[model samples]
Target: MRIRTAGVVAVLGLALAASGCGDNSKDEPAAKDSPKAASGKLVIWADDKRAAALKPFGEKFGQENGVTVEVQAVSKDLQTNFVTASQQGSGPDVVVGAHDWIGNLVQNGAIDPVQLAAEQKSAFNETAVKAVTFNGQVYGVPYATENIALIRNTELAPEAPKTIEDLVASGKKLKAEKKASEILCLQSGQNGDAYHIYPLYTSAGGYLFGTAANGDYDPKDLGVGKPESIAAFQKIAKLGEKGDGALKRSITGENSIATFTGKKCAYLVSGPWAIADAKKAGIKYDISPVPGFAGGKEAQPFVGVQSFYVAAKGKNKALAQEFVTNYVTKPDLAVALYNAEPRPPALTAAFDQVKGTDPDLAKFSEAGKNGQVLPAIPAMAAIWDPFGKAEAAVIGGADPTKTVTAAGKTISGQIK
Candidate 1:
């Protein structure tokens, strides 16, 4: 499988979403292709955003090591592409992708664990390091971290919603005044969207999996079918169209941002990715935690980290390790990647440097301050479609108990 450029990445991006918890680990049978190895050289694959900034460092590494270093752009479906290529013994020495890719990558034997010193690990945000660490080893060197947060229109609701109820109440009043067409742009589509709804789910006491004693996700501890999940979705159902009409199926993933940008909604539960559109639409917005249910637990969004992994089957394994462990771990590279992508830098020094220049990054970092590290275990893949459909069904007025209960069964079957 050949890797494509940034302009055509949707398919690769959907690979993981199609398969499980992310775009990086999308489900596909492994395909073996010939290795594209260049003699006496080191190759690194990454998205376009980081390639340019990484070039100089790659060259510097080559100069010091007396080897040619190629920084290739594998802008599309990087994680899946890397995996498939690895199967054929034909992937780059290093691959840059989301931290969540660890589970599937490790399962496919595509990436080698990156060994970082204690201080080296401490140099990064703990969450980034944790996301890259699966089981007992770290497989990637993280550069940045990101998560969703509430983006509210300042003019429509000056103060941040203290709770999810406050957000809904304010929206309903605005709806009554004909000032807004929707209550909120949370976007539960026809089939449901677990990602967008996770804050509310967790706030109402839902969890996907519990951590092992070692602090890694324990696949055996499934949370979807448990009573806590049922209780959580029951609360989620109340906000659906069948009950308070706060969460409408009409507010789909495609339209939520548009709806918010058009001023049809006072609040939008989204990530930093949505900020550009808000700025373009000239909406007066402020970032905050996705408010929880009134008097309930604090809302928690899933935290994601973007990092560099050394491909286990690369042509040059030792060089791959050197590149990831020594070259990619720098604070400047972290800052450079952040400039290209604008997520929170994982390295403390980079984060400190950027936070002074970009307050929005700081705001978002705080928004996900207490957020849960999104589970990267293979079991996590099973929860997406089943849970999404169930949530959508509940939002559309189906019995939350029956719908969520059935969805839990589906997930259990897959994981089993």
Candidate 2:
């Protein structure tokens, strides 16, 4: 992916809904194309918005297949509930959720590998496909991709900063001029947010896990507690409360976008989901890559893919496979989903059509060119809380080296 030289003129809005928890351990079973009658009922579960968007498509598909299609809206705990219901042999044939849930879904035998032809697989964003793949098998059909970018108010800071140092300098100037109340709106709450802070962490040379030869994260090769991670934390300390005072526990995920939309800050490190509020606030803004450290590596955010999975133990496996493998791959369906939620389409064809109207999709895609796919390995569950708390402590003035080292140990223990 290349970062194109594009100016953000008309901004588009997006909202990334709830991402739930799941993990994978054993190899997922392959989806077999069983020859069966298509007249049976096909039930699908999704969050409210997606359910609403899919109803029309589902009805059309049902009519074409001579079947009944029910798109149920599970407002809360969709992933956990799907898992529980699948285990009891009572879940829907299809479930829409984040790709990160592939691990646990596979581990619990709640979802099956989604069979896609080579051309179909290649039709979507490469990173989106990679996110839904587990143990070398594609497990879901991805619809949208999301990652954080540097969203700056053009009215407050006309030019995009090249690096973290440059951003800090510009923000400091804005604050000193009494034009802005805060320097940056990157969130680091009391418990920390590893997801939102990942760009900065990587820019400072910190890594979560080492990758294997297959390009999969190696759970055994934890990068925390290492010399490089210690060095990275030390660098981050300079931006903490004890240093530049830019990162604050008060700036949370719930409020970071508001801070920027409210014009209290010049810059916000956020994803496409925040764009809706930003557009509503009527701020003249532009999107760019989250700048890296002065001499460090490029800042890489976590790329999250939203996907649809086939329940492993659903009553209508044949119908489910037909819907997920064939019906869901259509560019029109992808375009419709985008219209419902306005995320960057994972399908290349759909994205191509949408980019002409929603140029912010192109800008966001450029911003996340160097992004790392959010890991879906079961071991990843162990890294969140411990790592987040350690990050919070360091941001609140704890010893960077000691605190990070302890976090690494805690994560290691949990993984073990």
Best by the TM-score measure? 2
lDDT of 2 by residue, 1-416 (tens): 11121111121121211221112213432233332433367788988888878988887766665566788888888888999899888788899999989888999999988867776777889999999989999999999998889999999999999999999999999999999999999998889999988888999899999999999999999998988888888888899899897888889988889999999999999988888999999999999999999999999999999999989988888678878877788889999999988889999999999999997898899989789999999899998898889888998999988999999999999999
User: Mind sharing the TM-score for model 2?
Assistant: 0.91
What alpha-carbon RMSD in Å does predicted model 2 have with respect to the real structure?
9.3
- Leading candidate by lDDT: 2
Candidate 2 error regions (>4 Å): 1-39
Supply the global lDDT for candidate 2.
0.85
lDDT measured at residue 150 in model 1 versus the true structure, 0 to 100? 90
Q: Spell out the clash pairs found in candidate 1.
A: 15-26, 16-26, 19-27, 35-90
List per-candidate RMSD values in Å: 8.7, 9.3
